[model samples]
Target: MRVVLDAMGGDNAPQVPVRGAVQAAKELGVEVILTGKRELIEDELSKYSYSGNLIKVVDAPESISMDEQPSKALKKKNSSVHVGMSLIKNKEADAFVSAGNTGAVMAISVFSLGRLKGVERPAISTVLPNLKGHTFLLDVGANVDCKPHHLLQFAVMGEAYAKYVLGDENPRIGLLNIGEEETKGNELTKEAYKLLKKASEKGLNFVGNAEGRDIYSGDFDVIVCDGFVGNVALKLSESLAKILAKILKEEIENHFISRLGAITLKPAIKSFKKRIDYAEWGGAPLLGVKAPVIISHGSSNAKAIKNAIKVACQFAESNLNSYIEKNIEKYG
Candidate 1:
């Protein structure tokens, strides 16, 4: 299958994207189309040893920066983000991956490709490595304000994603709230609780509300929240993971005995780091879209980009959109 990447959208730009695209083409056996300035992409690409024929470049002279407003950037027809979306819209590519501006990607995607047939609004489903295995959360920074119906749709989409992409048989769905009780949250969560319970009676394996502490507790397979709360949770987790890792490193260096202990625990520490690394998942899948599009981290490295391609390929192979539409209709 063919996958298109926004080569000039990330922090490292053409280099990381080019290297990742080549690695993906070689390792994943998928054709990659890099969209950006032809010369810059070629220059970076020439630095690597790859199957030249498997990787192609489509010239997109302009690029949308991370700081640019999503609404304003959408008007740039020649931007890499725009061009990449067009390729997907035209069916020239199976999926598109980018580590560029998140807002721009989401905005352009909805305007260019439209949402799935019964989807109220598309949500970003981000998978985090939990103690048991993993937990999928949405709408992470997509829709700031949402209705009760929107949260239900997020639950439905999250469960479908857990089954298809993450390979969970019966993923438990939970609403992120102040407390686990039905009477717990603001008006939004309280109303959504009843709807989710009703949905559970239908087909969903809806578990009750999930507190913030329960996020990494691994009790819930999929957690649903409005974009505001979800984004805060996501940011806090990412920051805490990095800070804790740094603190451990410093503490190990401060004491000789601690250093010796660290050496003994080196294997476990390495394994723990691998589990929480965002690079491993590559990117978050923009669930509820018409096709697959992975939104990678802005600071993504070559490894992250390659893994993002793997995710895009997996998404393309799954009947995700159709499954979501069918499930939404059941609830409708």
Candidate 2:
């Protein structure tokens, strides 16, 4: 399978992405097409030794910056984001992975690949490590403002992903709300609750509402919310994980006894760190698009980019969009 990497999109552009692409081609055994200035990409690629045919380069003179407006960025047809997306639109590549501007990637994807037949809006689905393995959350930052039907669509898309990709059977779906009661949230979620409950009859396992504390409890397999709330939750959780790790390290160093204990528990600590590392999952898939588009963090490293490529490959191989389309027909 072929995967396109936006080599110039991330914070450590060209270098990190190029290294990651090479690693993916070597380790994952997939052809990688790096999109960026040909000279820059080739320069970084020369640092690594690999099979000539496994990695290719496409020149995209322009690049969309993280701070650029999505609408304005799209006007640059030669931008890396646009070119990479176009490759997928033309079927030259199976999937596109970018660690660039999230808004630009999403906008370019919708513009180039279009949306699924019945999809009103595309949602970003992220898998977070939870007590029971993991939890799938949707609308992590795609649509800040959504109507009741949009949340229903998010639930349907989230459910399809959890069941097919994550291997969850009858995935428990929940609406992110303040309280567990049916009428707990604002009009959007309250109205969305009724729609989700009704959808439960059509095959969705809508399990009432999910409070903030239940997110990592793993009680629910999938949680749907507006982008505003979901994004805040995602960022806050990430920060908390980092701060907790730092605090633990500081405490361990503060006392000689604690430092000695840390050495004995090093393996466990390492395992815990791995569980919360964002690089493990690499990227989040933008559902509802015609083709598989994986969006990585803007600050992604080589490992993250490589894993993102793996996710794209898996997403494409699963024929996930077809399953989502079928479910949308059933639940919409």
Candidate 3:
């Protein structure tokens, strides 16, 4: 399978993404096409010794900045993101991965790859690492203002993604709300709960309402919400993890005894970091699209990009779009 990488979009740009493409080409045994300025990409490739010959570069002169609006930026045909999406549209690549602006990625995917049959709107689904395992959350900053039906679609798409990616045959789903009671949320959540309840009767494992406090406890395998609330939850969790890590480091370095103990417990701390690290999870997939599109962190390193490539490969091989199309009637 051929996976396209946006080499000029993220913070580290050509260097980190190039290294990642090389690693993924060697380790995953898949072809990687890097899209960016040819000279910059070639220069970075020179820094690494790659065993496989599966890596290639596609030159893109223009690049969309993080601040540019998706609608306006898409008009630039020469942009790196545009070039990458064109490759998918032309069947030159199996999937497209970018660490660029999230809005642009969503907009470009919809415009170029188009939405799948029976899908009204495409939503972004992210994997949240928890104590028991990972909880899949959808509409995470994709559509801020969603109708009740949009949320129902999010649940349907999220369930399909969690089941296929997480290897769960019957993943339990929950609606994010203020309380566990059925009549506890705003109009949106209340209407969404009813739709999900009806969906449960038709084969989906709907576990009812899930509050914010229950998210990290693995109360459900998939949590469904509008983009507004989902974005808040995702950002808050990420920020809290970083703050907690910093505080722990400060405490460990405060005294000689504590420093010694920290050294002894370094391995345990590293393990803890890995568990909460967003990089370890790779990227978020844009579900309900005809083709695979992954949006990685803007500050992603080589390892994160490599993992994202692996994720794209898995999604392509799974034939998830066909599965979702076959099961869409059950969700409605």
Better-scoring candidate (lDDT), 1 or 3: 1
**TM-score of model number 2:** 0.97
Model 1 has an lDDT value of 0.91
**lDDT comparing candidate 3 with the true structure:** 0.87
lDDT of each: 0.91, 0.91, 0.87
Worst 10 residues of 1 by lDDT: 45-54
Per-residue CA lDDT of model 1 for 165-272, tens digit only, reads 889999999999998789999999999999999988898899999999988999999999999999999999999988988997898899999888887897997888
Q: Give the CA lDDT, 0 to 100, for residue 159 in model 1.
A: 91
In the predicted model 2, the residue pairs found to clash are: none
lDDT of 3 by residue, 215-277 (tens): 788878888888888899999988988898899889878877988877778798789878877
Q: Show where candidate 1 strays beyond 4 Å.
A: none
**What is the alpha-carbon lDDT for the whole of candidate 2?**
0.91
RMSD of each: 1.2, 1.3, 1.3
Residue 316 CA displacement from its true place in model 1, Å:
0.6
As a TM-score, model 1 comes out at: 0.97
